[model samples]
Target: MKKKSVGIIAEYNPFHNGHLYQIEESVKATGAEVVIAAMSGNFVQRGVPAIADKWQRAEAAVRSGVDIVIEIPTVFACNSAHNFAEAGVEILENLGADFISFGSESGNIEELKGIARVIEENSEYIENFISKKTKDGWSYPRARRAAVESITGASAASLLDSPNNILAIEYIGKISNALPVTIMRTGPGYNEFETTEKFASATAIRSLINENEDISHFMPEEAKNIFLKSEPVDKDVYFRLICHKVLSADSTDMEKAPAGGEGLANKLKASIRMCSNLEELSESLKSKRYTRTRIDRFICQTLLGIDREKKTDNYIRVLGLSSNGREYIREVKKSETCRLPIITNINKDIKNFKGIGYGISVDILAADIYNIAAGKDLYRFSEYLRRPFCE
Candidate 1:
């Protein structure tokens, strides 16, 4: 009998017990024999640096039962929700995944499906939404939620407010349009701050780690060990790099950065000199039209030199894979549907791939540079981190 496979798009900054539960539930729901995770690299969707590198995170996923881990290029990894969803969906499709699973606050798929339909159709509500936002100076997300509430009379305001629900809706929208994969929903909110009755947020776990608090209660034993053994790069270093780029780079160069638009370049250039840290710069630059996350992503893009218009997923950068994952890759290798080459090493040739984005390349380079600056040779140590499925 053939085994079933499901793909999970994630950034396992530190794979916790909740993540383990989600993986278990996804497998149970989908009856998938294999779980392929398209995970974010050194950065995450919220524009903050990931606590762990891709390889370490991938190892955690594998240890927790993920069959294979593919890299969601940093360009998409650090962008807005919609693009992140699109990129993840595209990668799953390329891998010929049969289903995609994600966590959500509103586990009601029908509600998400309805919202997806509204967004897809570009319904009259969206136009009214834009108009209302233009008048009230609301952020895009806030305006969209307000419009949905007004047009549907369904009290979608609460659903729209939850970050996990927002991403879940985007995932549904992405799958609804072209992908043939089924969807599996999980419990818990992505941004939940406190330990809930059954689930805790990744954000809370990271906060605990940042404050040198005990996270063993939240994370798996293996995950806690990984986090303890590995030291995270200084957040200040990356922030300073971003600030320097913003202050020194020409407007034209900054304009080409990912999420750079609508005079954001000038705003960032002006704000970088005034603010001292990433959080302060974000606060200074955030406007009613652009959210803090969006500005943070733009700063990351500027640091990585990502050109938004030129972004593409041209390679399947494998972070880790289990035995089952290796088998799946072997099966897919024979199919014409898998277009991008699987890349394991960065120093090797990749320039032949056309759709490879500047952001992705720069991100890889930056990670290497980050490793070197911190006095650790990442290239040498990166391979040791990669383990076989069984460890």
Candidate 2:
């Protein structure tokens, strides 16, 4: 039998104690010798810039015990939960992982799989059910829950209440090849604002950082050091760019956006004149038909020149890898298991990776936006300028 490696799909927006715990526990639970992570780039699933750049975030994972770190496409990174989870699992599977590991409120893998089964078996009916609820002015998550409850019953549907459980369900639903292992989540839940010494949510850490409060206790020493050197993207500066994009561009041209810029694009443009900040902009544009996350993703696509029209996830980009990580990739390459080429630097390797021209093009473009947003430049933001952090 082939060696068993566990893959983790995460943002690691700032790798904290909780992330470290998940990694340690995953290794113990599955006896997987190698741990590979498919992480988001500059943008995250929430439709916001990551607290730290991809380099720092990826490096943090390496220092904390991840064997290999690969970048998920920016378009998928800044998309909806389903899109994000699908691409993440795809990349990990492509990397030849034997099993995927995740932290969830309900550590029972069977329960999450049960919900996944209900959705997969009744996909057509569930889609119709969600569509009906959406037409009636319910949010996607709300509509999805109603549909899930109909199939899985209210007891199972309640599992979707926690953020990790919802993502765990998505992972279970998306993975086609690898088995999934759920590591019990310890401490506060997702977006939990206050943190104890032993546990703090990524949301709480970012909030604390914004307040200039010390979070040394919550983050790994190495991750915190890298985080301190980098500056977080300012919402006002980027929102200024987003606001202008909404105002100057023809609403008719929004078909490239995720929701087809007709109603939602017009809503953003209509509300553009009154909004003052990113928070207000997101709030004003949110409706039953389009959500805040969808609106934020639209803005991300609009600015980065990404559209639903050309969504091709054809390559896995390496951000950072430890020594064992290098060994793992070599084995995967020799085995010829991954369908898509793995690239270290897009500018240098795009030519080598066939049929991924568009994917690389957007990957480069997104870094440019991230550089401008984070107030970094060619010194740090340029993809070709930095070497892979192989320790």
Candidate 3:
């Protein structure tokens, strides 16, 4: 009989104990013999550079309990939750995963699926409402809440309040071929910086690392070692890079980037002149309608040249895999349903491709800038030089 497989979509910004627990429990709950993770590359959804590079983060995940780690290209990785979830689920489905697993605050998959169903059924109405609201200076999240409330009442809209629950809905809504399995999230909340007995949110872990505090108990032994050895990318450096990129870019060009419309490009251009760092720039641009995260994402989009109109073919970029992971890859490749092109070796595989799309170019640019932020060697075409991690 063939072994069962489950897929997870995560940043693993730095793999933590909570992530390890989720992976272990996902296996237990689903009876999955293989676990595959679609992880963010150099950038994360929150519009920030990951503490460590993608390869190192993938290494940490593999060292922990994850069987396979594939790269969610930077274009989708650093965008809104909807795009992030869509890209991740598409990758897993194309990779021939039998199930898709994620962490959720409510843990009740039924309620989450219900929300997804409602939204899907009323998608046109909800989107039209949201469009009108956003045009009236309402943030997307608030507009979405109001739209949901209009159709299903406040009770259903309230479900979108939790970050994990919101993501769970997106995953459930986007998933077509794979079964959805959600593990109850424990420890601190998504943005919480507090530590628990043996678990801490990735946010807390990053904060602890920044403060040079002991995070030994927060991560698995092998993962901790990998993190300690790698240099965390400096946020300030990333901010400065964004600022530099905008100096040469005009408002018209900046408007080409994601979320850079409605005079935001001009605002960003002016803000860059006065602000010393990212926070200051975000604050200067933030208003009742525009959020700090939105501003930050726009800034990142500009730096990475993320044009919303640019069409790119999505491919599965495998970063690392354990022994079981390798066998699973071979099995999936042999299956007729697995049609997505898998790139394990960058130099060899990428060269054969006809043309790289804007989405992929953004990923390549992301790596180059990530190395700059992390103060690593800046070899030209460095993406081709680096090889995937295999254990």
Clashing pairs in 1: none
Instruction: Name the top TM-score candidate.
Output: 3
**Two-way lDDT contest, 1 vs 3, winner:** 3
Relative to the unseen true structure, what is the C-alpha lDDT of residue 298 in candidate 3, on a scale of 0 to 100?
89
What's the CA error at residue 373 for candidate 1, in Å? 6.8
List ranges where model 3 is wrong by over 4 Å: none
Show model 1 residue runs off by greater than 4 Å. Answer: 123-128, 131-136, 176-188, 196-199, 347-352, 357-360, 369-375, 378-390
TM match of model 2 to true structure:
0.96
lDDT (tens digit, per residue) of candidate 3 on 290-357: 88888888888889888888877778899999999999888887775666678887767777665445
**lDDT ranking from best to worst?**
3, 2, 1
lDDT of all predictions: 0.74, 0.84, 0.87
Considering TM-score, which of the candidate structures 1 and 2 is the better prediction for this target? 2
Weakest lDDT window of 10 consecutive positions for candidate 1: 176-185
TM-score of each: 0.89, 0.96, 0.97
